[model samples]
Target: MGILANTVSFRQYQVLGDPPAGDPGEWAGPLLAKNAFVPIDSGSEEISSGWVCLDDPQNGSFAERRDFFRPPSLAFTLRRDQRRVPAALLRRHLQKAEEEFLAAHPGLHRVPKDKREELRDTVKGALLARTLPTPSFFDAVWDLERGLLTFTGTSPNIAEIFEGLFRQTFEGLRLVVLHPFARARALLPAKLQPLLEEQNRAATDAVLEQIQENTWLGADFLHWLLAHSVAGRNSFRVRRAGPALMDEAFVAFLDNRLVLAAGPQRVTVAGPQDHYSEARIALDAGKEIAEAGIFMEKGEDAWKTTLKAETFLFGSFKAPGVKPEKDGITDEKSEREAIFYERMHVLAEGLQLFDSLLLAFLEERLAADWPKRREQLQRLLGFEEQ
Candidate 1:
């Protein structure tokens, strides 16, 4: 899903290096053009991946700044085209070829392994040539000001591909996933940062290590949210900087679905959780929240999303739609630009609200009396100390 969509599922990364000194366009514009997606229709290449215009995946031209640059951000789509030959079809063709080859060799009862391998490759290539390459596009928006990148997909394989392609294209910059701990660090005030660091169990800065060591951050946050949701304590104030006003009141809570896990045991409770009885049972069984659907509301606006605990990835995040008034006087391009900015504005507001909620959790979590509070939560959820 694209960022402009009413609902978008994305994972964010922090860009870890600086660009060249001067107009960013001087470097980025040319680089984007150089790494633009190339169609594989004329060739037998199995796959191709490169950047394309965000608005038009088919248009790889990056001749103007407006193509990708939207002031403080650069938006583009990563296009991957791949051709796959059906295994059955390839096997059938290879078998036919092997039989013909063996029939031509009067003494041979079976095709040689080398000859069979060669025939298979030939058949596969022929099939690929005849097949049209299926194209897939993943949108990305780079917040140049904050050095963050929002990618519109959550698959690990695709993330790896994106990181590699981004490094290959930009040369100096690298992407680091904004995992739970990293995000917490970013959200913390200077005085409380040391407290967060003390809790970091990872000996190294590796992403997997950080997540594995800091599972408590996500687990506890969800547990806290679930506890509060059931207790009707869903109100919070904005404490992070973004599109929303400072200290603005908002309501956020877990709802619709909740995924809990303990070791290999996993359970999913769905539907409007009036009592969250199933979740409480799972908690009693030593399961913690691995993911849950989150809903946030401020006045008339609302946002809904599934929050992945381990990686903090937001799935199916539905922000309030941008309904531009019909001023029939505006051109299509101008209207598109307006919609893009408005969408980005709302998206930022949604993220701010989420981060504020996390900050609220952290404030309580890192407090001196968290152990006491945690125990209270346990008692409320009917969890026996193990």
Candidate 2:
């Protein structure tokens, strides 16, 4: 099954190796069960079987692990469960009961610490036995032919567990997290390679500084683009090394909605009608973009995705204009291989566009330019200066 937009966030991995021989329908279940989680009956933490078919073939039955083979790809759900007793609540109840016991037996002195600890354990055990487990679900798709696996998840812990489980389930397959650094390392030009490689050699926050530098550029570029779009200016030009000129395309329009968060708790979201003004208000109120649904056409293909500003992560990418073709393909394997590589190439291009736009923003605009531009945006949107 393919990743569905709106609900899940995902990261792509370059799966390495040919598809395992034998019918996936027959061996998939055995592989999944090999590393499946076992739920403890009465423990504070219990992890359930994390691997299962995404769509249950049988109604209310897990025998549907056989349904994982959906032609060229295998899709499944990774789930984990955690059960815990609230320590504070249990302790509070134990303390109240201890006080009652002391009051009843006024002849006895203070209860021994060891006996009190015993009571505490009893209370904790009772609570643990009664509490229900919290469950987490993630979607995973394994493209058998192209050696590409896309995990529909975002959390690092879940990702770690997923990687371990995946390796255990399918021996020799390793998942390299395609984080920004990893992507940059894989795709950045040779000249800038040293900057990334030597970033962490000296422990002066260089690696983090590099990341922040890029992140700031990305945010400022988005901010600058929004300002220019509001003012009806879209074209941009970049000066490359020597006399060469590089065409810069960072045009993006706010799509359906914008999501902004002031801090950890407050989020102000608005839809398309007067969305720019809503965004200005949120910005003026000291909010950072949590997610911005944007439509961007930088070069060959237009991209529609929700951009998470904090991490510069794109989600639910819609690349309709760039479709892979299998024009001369005769066999199913060849066709699948062509489509997979094409999709990967398009994704790589999108990432390259992202890097180029941020570089352009940093080079073409200075830090001193932001305040004036920000004021102009606020004034245009009719928001009072803070």
Candidate 3:
């Protein structure tokens, strides 16, 4: 089963700084209305047209309710409408218009440049007028105590728009992607606090090693997993805070094509399951993992999702089966609440697993041991079998 429904993908972020004082709901009400979405400029190539409240727009009930501070969730809709004037269609129309102009003015030898330009504008305006805007829903849930907010998308572009709009809506607030170091720091033991600080301070001379920004550490971490699949029995483990593990059991690499279903039950695998060999080859050839589908058993439940290599953002996560209501009846509100809780729990475990793996990588293993691990991978893959 797909890990998530309704939402196609996921992007998680931590809201930086403290939340505003007072009832969050009361504070959010006015701001939501002020920054509510409007339609896009149909003729322009702009994508982030405007935002509207998904819960309520005209009535401004979003402000009337107090969910922003208590539990911390905001739902909104973004619209993008674009119309492209096809070169061929515009050319044909212009040709027709030019012929009509010529017919109307027989003395004119050639259509003036200004007249052609005017026709192009006319065609563009007409096309734009007939176009409809596309709407997308963005859900944001903040963990007020933890200063974190997860956006239900992974697109950097969308994330940027969300960041801009969020700041506009909630002044002095910023959303930053929880990088490998930041995430790892959260899971590391108190004794290992120095390791995170070493990395953060850019301590070039520190013995614990440091990570640079924009380094493909997440991809490298996955590659390291492929290399030390056997060593995972002793090498990869996390304890103290919460039980978390990362090994071969949780990873799948998807290159291009994907499989939907294969069995008579019509059970569909979201992506190409048989492409494991191809994925490995792609990795061997130095192509980074575009997407990593991971299944992890954490805190007594199985959670699965596709994680982006660049950002470690979870996408399309599926939790275990849901129990039906005892009376065989459920309301839409209860169902929504149930799914939201499940998603949050599954996402929490996934993040923990991610942080555990990242900590393992940064804990002297990558810098001190990755070279030998690389040789092992090259040998296993027949690149240097000798």
Candidate 4:
């Protein structure tokens, strides 16, 4: 689903480097237009990818500021078209071609390797030309003021493609995945940042190293939240900054599904878990939470998402739906703009609530009395031994 959808799954990226100094719309307008999507329907290319309008994939124009630029935010969609040929069909065609070649030459028992390869290429090209291209659209919203980008897709291959395209389109700028440790460091206060750095397990500044080495951050946070929820301690105060007021009370808990992993083996516990007995068993077996469905609510607003522990990616994130509230709105364009801003507003608020919950966990996890709290949590989970 796209960003406008009621439920969307996405990965967050931290944009690095700086853009050309000028009216952002001035330089960005040309860049988006220059790298706009081109139709591959007439060509036999296997794949093609480029930027398109967020609302209309068929429209790639970015001439005006209203087209893609939304002040400090730029929204666009990455459209990828791919053509595939069945391997079995290709093999059959190649075999028939080889038989025809052998029949034409009476003395030849088999086609030569060079001739066979040539025939295979010809067959593949023919099959590709006859095949229709499948198109996919992934939406992206880049918050220039915050240097953060949210992409409405979670596939690793698609993310790699998006990163490459983003780097190519915007010269000098690159994207860094906002892994657990990086996010933790970003969320920590100035006083606690040094303490977080003290707990860093990665030997290098590489992204993968940061994520793989500090996976405990996510696992322990989920474990803490799970334990708290089981103990009926689901209320927390907002600590990190954003749309939510500081010290505002919110409720968050883990339920519906929980994924636990121990090395190569993994277990998924689904449905409405009463006291999460099955998950507790897995936890006792030394499996750490790799993912879980997190639900947060504050007053009338609510958000739900399956959060991937390692990468902190949100899967099937459902934010509060918004509609145009302006009475007597006759113009479609104005209505769309109104809905867009409302969606962004709620999205930001959801993210803020999540970050606040994480901060609450971090403050406890990083404190000097953490060992005592850990012992208490272990006791609550019936893990008194370790």
Best candidate (score: TM-score): 1
**Model 2 score (lDDT):** 0.59
TM per candidate comes to 0.97, 0.56, 0.69, 0.97
Question: Which portions of model 3 show Cα errors greater than 4 Å?
Answer: 1-8, 39-48, 53-70, 75-91, 98-115, 185-213, 230-290, 298-300, 321-331, 364-386
State candidate 4's TM-score. Answer: 0.97
Please give, for residues 1-386, the per-residue lDDT of candidate 4 as tens digits. 99988899999989999878988878887898788888889989889999998877898888767768777789999999999998999999999999999999999998999999999999999999999899999999999999999998699899999999899899999999888998887888899998888889999989989988999999999999999988889998878678889899999999699999999999999998888899988999899999999999999999999999999999999999987666675677667776787888889989999999898889989999999999899877767746
lDDT of 1 by residue, 9-93 (tens): 9999999988767777666788888889999999999999999998888888887787788978988999999999988988888
Clashing pairs in 3: 3-317, 3-318, 11-153, 29-63, 37-51, 37-52, 258-272, 259-271, 259-272, 260-268
Ranking by TM-score: 1, 4, 3, 2
| Candidate 3's TM-score | 0.69
Task: After superposing candidate 4 on the true structure, give the runs of residues whose Cα lies further than 4 Å from its correct spot.
Answer: 324-329
CA lDDT, candidate 3, residue 292 = 59
* Candidate 1 worst ten-residue window by lDDT: 377-386
User: Residue 109 lDDT in model 3?
Assistant: 94
Name model 1 segments beyond 4 Å from true: 324-326
Q: Evaluate model 4: give its lDDT.
A: 0.90
Cα-based lDDT at residue 82, candidate 4: 95
Q: Write the per-residue lDDT of candidate 2 for residues 1-386, one digit (tens) a residue.
A: 23433223567676755556887777776777565555555565434546755543111223453356665677677867777667689878898868877888898788678878987777777776778877667767776765657786777677788888888788877776544445445544576666555433323424345444455434555665565555656544432321113565446565666676755755646565453776766777776656777665655556676776655556776653434364664665445445544554455445445555545454334434656766775566566557
